[model samples]
Target: MVDSAIITDNSEVLLHFDLKLEDGSAADSTRVHNKPAKLVMGDGSLTPNFESCLRGLKAGDKKTFTLPPDDAFGMPNPDNIHHMERSKFNLDAPAEVGMIIGFTQPGGMEIPGIIRAVAGDSVTVDFNHPLAGETVVFSVEILKVK
Candidate 1:
């Protein structure tokens, strides 16, 4: 019932987060950008599970927790993997494995796709999120909960 000191629906929160993989390798961190994230609690930007973790947290609280693939970014879908002809790519810099490229959708919105493989004249592009299927640990330093 104490709304001022704790996170609640519609509360404006400012926090820094560190996202890491199961192997303890760094995935991403707000500290690296030096700009803490600002968002309203219960916003659609956060996954339901992630928001649940922040529900009771207050300013100056720091916590780290792990999320399964489903609750995190989610599992990869086979339908997200597309095969295209090598000719579809620019000849100057052809598609190569591990390359991330922006693919324009029918609505003109661009999404990132990773080049997974190249065999003969075929190119495989994975449209799944880069962190899909990952069990990640998210550490949050709550700066301002209201």
Candidate 2:
């Protein structure tokens, strides 16, 4: 058994989850594959609101919650879309729809951008998360809390 309060800042947890879109379409589900994901709390990886929902949950507890766009991946920003010359990419790389390219940031972090479209000389890349701006429904089963 696991204490719910222990699931706080910097705590590590293992859980299986199913994520669904607003349309009731299944986006991701651990139940189907039976693999649990590990997550560290308060790492900025999960929004505060989303973390709040997990508060007081113990192991073996199953909970389903809905999160708005802001509480999830966040709203997509138009500025995250960048149009670059096709020549900027390596010819061998092959720019295709859904290809992810890593761009080096000022702090040396590699940011991934998905290729949205390719025109004559311009290639459109979007840095926004693929699930951004979409409300999410999560069904979570707490497997372990540490």
Candidate 3:
């Protein structure tokens, strides 16, 4: 039996997690050597289905589940790729392949874009998350329930 109220909307939880891809490739894992991640439920930071899986789980509970791309980061959008003049970037920054750069948005929010390619004067950046279209497997161990 577990305390249902231990896991509720807005509750804070500490969990050690491992995120894997469909090919059994390890994408990210806190279990390797990192502190547990702290997240507040229903904060829009987590997908509804992910949060649903945590519901009714208490401290010391462990679970593993897979989330489809749509439920995780959602599929990548073609529109997220944009080509801009190399001059638009700071020369000191030095555009390189696979480098993530932060671009300021109209709303003052910084969006991270990965450098996909660079030509003589044009640079292609992709705003989609690296894991956007990948189905992810999450293995979670609840450390604390608050």
- Maximum-TM-score candidate: 1
**Position 22, candidate 1: lDDT:** 99
* Arranged by lDDT, best first: 1, 3, 2
- Misplaced by over 4 Å in model 2 are 1-6, 31-33
Flag the better candidate by TM-score, 2 or 3: 3
* Alpha-carbon RMSD, candidate 3: 2.2
lDDT of each: 0.92, 0.86, 0.89
Cα lDDT tens digits, model 1, 77-108, are 99999999999999666899999999899999
Give each model a TM-score. 0.92, 0.84, 0.88
| Pairs in clash, predicted candidate 2 | none
lDDT of 2 by residue, 28-71 (tens): 88778777888888877667887888777768888999998989
Q: What ranking emerges by TM-score with the best candidate at the front? A: 1, 3, 2
Error of 3 at 1 (Å): 13
Candidate 3: lDDT over CA atoms?
Answer: 0.89
Alpha-carbon shift of residue 129 in model 2 (angstroms): 1.1
